[model samples]
Target: MDPYAWSWNPEGLVVLLLAAGYVAALRRYPTPWWRPACFGVAMVLLLAVSVSPLHMLAMQYLLTVHLFQNVVLAEWAPLLVVLGLPPALAAAIARPSAMRLLTHPALALPVWLANYMIWHLPWVYDTALEHPSSLLHLEHALYFLTGLALWWSVVQDAPHELRAGTRAAVVFGAFVLVSPIGLVMALIPRAIYGFYVDAPKRLWGLSALQDQQLAGVLMALEQAVVFFAILAFWFARFFAEEDRREEIDRSPEAA
Candidate 1:
């Protein structure tokens, strides 16, 4: 594949079709407009980074682009998917005690962290790149799945799920745990991924070390954006819930 030009991925076509099918199902059993809207945005983001020319750039040219792509898939897309999940579907998920436990911080956090670290290891990273024909799609799928699990504990609205306070702690602690990987990547002066060392630069004037640093900054900045947004939401929600309870407490005595 030409690193600079548009390319048709069979997988991309399959994904687009599947996304369309999902949307059609949502229409048949529609929730609110916002649910489909969130889902549509997720699909667009998935296609933008995974199927578009951006994927080519990441695969062939820059580690920065690769990390950015992963961030979009892992962090951004899955969150939207969570928001878009139908109430009916969520209700079904509420039944299984074991499955519910999977979303707890203890389980979900470690699974996400382990899968993420495993993929980033030097040899694992290189091997995935080396077998782009096979392993690359699996790599992206793993990131997206782990991401879904990571956010599940924190984002669920079901009564069976973690309380808002616990969810907030889980998400914040995850940021503290995961941010260092990006920091190390951004602060390093030398190239960390040997795969890109001799690769030809396609668009940017960046050298390999610069590309790695850019990837790191992307990792750090994106995590900051997503984590802080969620935290702000939790803060407001926690205060609002507390105020509501106090208001009820202060209501006039009833017969």
Candidate 2:
């Protein structure tokens, strides 16, 4: 709870340095200012959730806070970072043989889903908490990375570029698969994580079970916002494209 004691982890340092380097590169490449700004804000958010008092709060006090961190890092941060990339840079990144393979939904979906489920397993979760030095960071990194790869398949290619129907399916499918985890967490009467049960956390005088359930509710709510927004956007784009194609087909030149 000592907000003064902010963490300065190597991962935070790396994220900052990469953002710095990317901003500098923008000068040479002449990319849009908003692009770097998106990246910069994403990095700041990364530091906040992972390295600030928020980090301590999650690590020691509240499971709900940790869940929030995971969603922000995995879902929000990666999506914004991908959106921030210049088209050329995005294309370059996507052009690689291995990158292409990993970004494909066939490979990305199960990896992301597994990464998510495995980390929640009781033993695995406890081990991560036990080893703050390595495994914890690994867990966070996996969350961010698998999310990045997952979002890459969605955002890097525009809605019109990809099969909009397929993109919608992936997003909706993820929503369905991930919601059960949250629902399970919320409905369970008992606490799940051992560390959070008695750990110096009495925020709002809430019990561990209450805190855990709140986390689940937040996760479920967050998934709805994220996935549904993406779905709405894709469907809108899909229908717009359809309308345009129909217009072209009915044009006088077509006759």
The most accurate candidate by lDDT is: 2
Candidate 2: count the clashes: 0
lDDT over C-alpha atoms for residue 40 of model 2: 76
Model 1 weakest lDDT span, ten residues long: 156-165
Candidate 1 local lDDT, 1-255, one digit each (tens): 578676566557755985877776676566888987887898888888867788888888888888988887778888888788787766566568876776667888888888778888767887888788789878888888778777777787653455567777878888888898899988977887888886765458888888888888889988998898898888777788889888888786541
Evaluate residue 246 in candidate 1 and report its C-alpha lDDT on the 0 to 100 scale: 83
| lDDT (Cα) of model 1 | 0.79
Q: Quote the positional error of residue 184 for candidate 1 in Å.
A: 0.3
Q: What value does the lDDT take at residue 131 in candidate 2?
A: 90
Distance from true location, Cα of 199 in model 2, Å: 1.4
How many backbone collisions does model 1 have? Answer: 0
Clashes per model (N, Cα, C within 3 A): 0, 0
**TM-score, every prediction:** 0.89, 0.92
Candidate 2, 1-255: lDDT as tens digits: 573368778778878887887777666566778877887788888988878888888877888888888888778888888878877777767887888888888887889888888888767877798798899999999988998888888877722246777777778877888788788889988998887876764776778999999999999998998899999998887788889888988997877
Show pairs that collide, candidate 2. none
